[model samples]
Target: MSIVQRFSKIFFYLALFPAVIVLCAWQGWAWWSWATAPPAPKSSTGETSDADKTVQIRIPPGSTSKQIGSYLESAGLIRSSNAWDLWVRWLNTQNKGVFKAGTYELSPTQSLKEIAEQISQGSVVQISFTIPEGRNLKQMAAYFESQGFFPAQDFLAATKQIPRDKFPWLPSGLPHLEGFLYPDTYQIASGGITPKAVIDIMLKRFEQVALPMYQKNPQQIKLNLLQWVTLASIVEKEAVIPAERPRIAGVFTQRLQKGMKLEADPTVEYGLNIQQTVDQPLTFKQVKTPSPYNTYLNRGLPPTPIASPGKASLQATLNPEKTDYLFFVARYDGTHVFSRTLAEHQAAVAAIRKQRVQQNQGAIPQPN
Candidate 1:
């Protein structure tokens, strides 16, 4: 080769080498920024509103990394889908993990790496729901429906079809999952959450929280699971004051031991599916009306639990306060007056009614 041609070739090689190095440096900087930087906020007024704060993006099952990236980009949760694809490829090479399928609550302020990691780790959006104590299965359904969780009928239907296969500890021949569902706050995954899933969670909670107490048999109560829950449900409905649970439970226990009718007002209401307001208390006619759940007319516990009892009521039923109290009457206040005999109970009831009448006539309230 000629000297001129060789010199030209050397210069070309040197120039090409520098250009390649600069290109590589630029690419590295771009990738670094893309990985670490969050998407720019789209608020024109320079303030993040509630809508712009967070977005819910669903990653469908069997979605490829590219598809997830595209979704994130469209939702304004990420800067670029191309960058996401490249980052995901790199993650695959490192065997970090696969992105799971679920609804994700993501914010635009989160970096690409943070969002990707969360998805990969299956950190799905969770919705917290609470079941207050003493709520019946029907009431629970209504509440769930009102909260947009599902249809009231769906929840009710799911309760009827108990998944005994998943929960072997569930009592056999359980007509419906009434008292079995634990009453407490629950964190449920946002997407694809069915009524069955919610029921399973609640039953699992019951198994975890309340079942252990029964297994321990601390009180050595002779009642089976059904009966224990039945009595607890009654206690839950009857007790207004938290401190009165044990005493109320004691009254029922004495009634049961003596083979006397419970005649609990709550049982009568449950059977009739009616709540007695202060202005309209349980009438004699209502109490006299016979139903399977009416403790007033029935001899023993109702066929099933009237409502879902909380931990306190369950505990109170298991370990009742030792007392001779066979009867009790509500004073319209949260407190109830306990009596050793029917005469005392009747007197207490009369006194409360008289006091209530006086209060209605603008008279001073008397102490129970």
Candidate 2:
């Protein structure tokens, strides 16, 4: 009797235990679903999701989460400002405040989680600008304005204030920073860098690249920083062909040594009215005109450089091509013909003039 009673009691307890386990599992599943479920359709604020359009938002420096949320809502990046704020705050609490300040690009289709991640990662707007070599401060300022980097007046004024002493390679007391702004494409924020800051960065880069080259040359050939820069500037303006730069430099150096007139066309062009084009053929009158910058009339280098030079021109000036050539004239083709003797130079000039006359005569319309 005792064995049967014990067996029945044990069987009853085992069945009861299974029922209790199933009930607990069901309750736990319900709790899990409630806790891990997606957010409600409408947040605490009365707002609906409009996930159809994309928008860009600028979260400026020192902006709070609430301010950023309002900006996002105003930009149409999200439908609910309050919902975005709450989500961002939740992230701040969870991730220990890792969000960064920037102008963020967001789409309405993005979930709060995705937008939050992008903002925290400092995703922002960017722009590209190109500063071409040999551009004067005025020209560079115009370029900055055209690219929306800064206002023209602001840049111009800032450029005027840049201390010439900061760049010893530039002639002292010049009107503005010249021959120091290195030219290259730069990625910058829209309206982010100050004009002075931009100029300073470029000049720094120029010094970094050019200083070593200046240091290595012999003292006679190695001019002081300013003279080297001047020579480089002349070399830059003299030849459009990369291969011709060293040869052009050689001719200038020869003239400098012999106390001869440089007679460089670029210097003549610089002396002419601003309307003159670099590519236009020079008239004999233009060459003979007396100006402070006219290398033909003057025996030494010009008062100042005509343009900013690039690395290649700088290098060519430092290490010129060794040749006996003292005169060079542009040939019928794009290249130049060099000569060592005055007679040879005269003959070359005559040949070039004859070719031009023949070409012009051939192009003239004959009477019917």
Among all candidates shown, the one with the greatest lDDT = 1
In the range 266-301, model 1's lDDT, one tens digit per residue, is 889988999999999988899899899998888989
Clash count of each predicted structure: 0, 0
Q: Could you tell me how far off, in angstroms, the CA of residue 128 lies in candidate 2 after the best superposition?
A: 2.6
lDDT assessment of candidate 2? 0.73
lDDT of 2 by residue, 217-322 (tens): 6544646676777778878876778899999999888888887888887777766744344246788788888898788888877766666788898889988888
Give candidate 1's error at residue 346 in angstroms. Answer: 1.8
Consecutive 10-residue window with the lowest summed lDDT within model 1: 34-43
Worst 10 residues of 2 by lDDT: 34-43
Each prediction's whole-model lDDT (CA): 0.89, 0.73
TM-scores of all models? Answer: 0.79, 0.69
Best by TM-score: 1
